[model samples]
Target: AKIIHEELATALGPNTPSYQTVARWAKRFREGSEDVNDDFRSGRPVSVLTDENIELVRQVINNDPYSIYDDIIAETSLCRGTIEQIIHNYLKMKKVTSRWIPRQLNDEQKQERVRLCRENLAKFRDGFWRLCNIITDDETWIYHRQIHHKSTNKTWIGEGASPRTIVRRSKFEPKNLFSMFFKSNGPVLIHAVDNNETIDHDYYIENCLKPVVKEIWKQRKSNGTKDIKLLHDNSSPHRHPHVINYLTEEGINIMPHPPYSPDLAPCDYWLNDYIKQNLTDQPDKKSLARAISKLIKNIPEEEFKKTFDKLLERLELCINNHGDYFEHLIK
Candidate 1:
């Protein structure tokens, strides 16, 4: 740009190219073309715009849109610029990063998800408020760490303002495992498992979950409710035959949940995020349990109700998407 301005000033005294003019010339110069004057080639007119080449390039890209420009050039026998133009202007395809799905579902898994969503949707449509009887649980690992403000979370500042440096949060400290159980009203159980213990079938059922289930059942029975629906993910411990027998004996109905579908779960979509956002530093298991219990009790009942409603929306979304991840449609 500076060189173009100098040349313009030298050729025509007191005349300067506008910024846009200089930018245009600079773009052309940067493309490795030094000759400012256009040169006409003597031969058949050079063209890659034939219908055959365009169709051929489109077919090649339709086979695999992730193909690079070089691949398209090899297949269509067209130049890099021509391939790029066809991809961008002709076919109108834009590259996008693949989003994170919990896990890719096979055909059977997808069918099962559709079936479960349909069943839940029917039940929900019959009695919308019946979702209040649902007792859902899930476990998550809480890291003893803090997050710094990232570049994506920054804001524009005025000139001369002090510059702020972003610091990366460390995660070398010990973490704790916690499980939560709740209805659309409040938490029924929030247990932080011992740091020394692994949450296998024996530990989860015998030590943590069964006692809470009995307590919750007693509480509900005293309040004139006999049956309650238990909704948890299809984790190994949760799906064990012994655990299922225990729940059956306790009179808790295990709700039908499709495998590999966390997006449809209230705990995954809302409660977990809520807990993580409100979580503060806690030193040990006792402190973590107390903090998590307090936070769970403090959450507004209306928030949980909204989560139940979101479940309906998500089921409909899943059906619409044919069992695909529906998290992107939350907003």
Candidate 2:
């Protein structure tokens, strides 16, 4: 019986029956029984869901929202599948990780967010800024080595087969900082920050703003640069007086961006993460800047237009949510 079980296990993998089950079947077959199924005798199957069990599961989950299937199983005599069914079907709840926000807001900051969202929403409502006339930019770091997401390691296998393993790269891995600026039409400028340089007021003027302004002049020949609305975060360099003056002299309309609000920024809520996702497991590169630039240039203009449309929806949602973080609620 043991030898047969081992052989069945090797060939059938997880489908192989237990040794006791095999022995019993072998005995039955010797007595001329050829049927594989159990003899009919039905009431409720072995595992059952009772009302008392449901209430118990509810109490356990209510006490601790973070409770897992195993945690509930340890507290009750119910099986894993029963507990899962109770939580999902009965209680209408599922386990989920918390969504990350850029930062927690104080009361004043939240009200400020509401005010700015209202202001921006009014601009779109009154036809002051078309999606194509808005320019936005942000900075993010690109790690030399891409992370192997644990979720992506999942694959189809036999029930008893072990899952594939993954080890994420270290948090302090070597990386490069890259800045990207784009409009609804497409990319205007993208470049890697020099390792030795700081992104100060002077650097912002010469490297980032100047090239973008020149592009604006070329792209907006019909309306001139005055019709363009610039949207960026309230970083120290971005808020510099000299930078403001330069933009004012260039006749660029500065859009008010709330502090600590990545949820509202196009690059933060979409572009940067999209770029990082597409960067994974591809051919190795000597320069991340070149790779990101190529990717941006190759993307269809419709995608950029779609993101800008979502920006309008997000602004309205921010107002409706009373400036709460609603990026998670957005698709």
Candidate 3:
């Protein structure tokens, strides 16, 4: 940019753009931004767009990213328009809500997560890529009738226009509890619990695992059942004595998952979210059920396999974090 500015100065002395202009355009091109427009005018005096006021607003924002605009104005003694212009125009920043995590882990739990991740990573050190040989499963609630999100219906409404009416059908919406099991190749089983059914030890073994074992037997006919490990969470019914006994009797090995660490699980990280993307904001119950059934019927092989690769990568990241929640670090 400096070299370009020198060239421009030599060719066109009076009409050449300033060095600042040349450098700013160079940066915009490098960052892949092509818009050739200034920030929208806020109708405030241009005097408030000074270096000192911008710096003050920046300092307050940096101290607390979650600080409201009013709070920033109070702290910096700046007017509303001045702050808005600084934040939206000069800083090129926007406020976003914090993301949710499964649990608020203490130091000990974080260390334990790191330890378990290290143990898992050691298994992959032999270059076998053991995730393909593992079967992952988890339970989630599937709503029968999904409500439309306000974000979906946003539009440019006139000030005096009548407000859009959205009738609420029921305060308590109907939903089904589903337990799903799948390997890297494809899904094995998705069992919808009976109405008002409590998932206990007996129901888990008889209703869930028994059918899952049958599918596993057919899937892994070449190797013994012990070769395929079961990766699951530390849920109550999952960790029950009868469930453990049932798995043992079938010669199915159990994969050790750290308690409260959903970030390390394949379904929690990828599969559940994959389903939610397609099923959210559905207004019809029967259509929602049909969509759910179709989705479970054909799990994408390529995308499903990618989840395993990402799983191994996440395990390494877990070790790097010393067992803290590391999903926020991804990408």
Q: Cα deviation of 262 in candidate 2 (Å)?
A: 1.0
What tens digits encode model 2's per-residue C-alpha lDDT throughout 24-87?
Answer: 9888989999998887788757656788899999999889888877888999978898888888
Per-residue CA lDDT of model 3 for 5-122, tens digit only, reads 9999999999999999999999988999889987578896568788988898899988988899789979988889878889999999888779887888899998888888888888
Cα-based lDDT for every prediction: 0.80, 0.85, 0.83
Worst 10 residues of 2 by lDDT: 280-289
State in Å the error of residue 324, model 1.
3.3
Q: Estimate each model's TM-score.
A: 0.70, 0.74, 0.71
- RMSD, one per candidate, in order: 9.3, 10.0, 12.3
Better of 1 and 2 by lDDT: 2
Candidate 1, residues 160-216, lDDT tens digits: the string is 897665456556667788888888888887787876777888887887667677767
Native-to-model Cα distance after best TM-score fit, residue 327 in candidate 1, in Å: 3.0
Ranking of all candidate structures by their TM-score, best first: 2, 3, 1
- Clashing residue pairs found in predicted model 1: none
Best by lDDT: 2
Best by TM-score: 2
lDDT-sorted candidate list, best first? 2, 3, 1
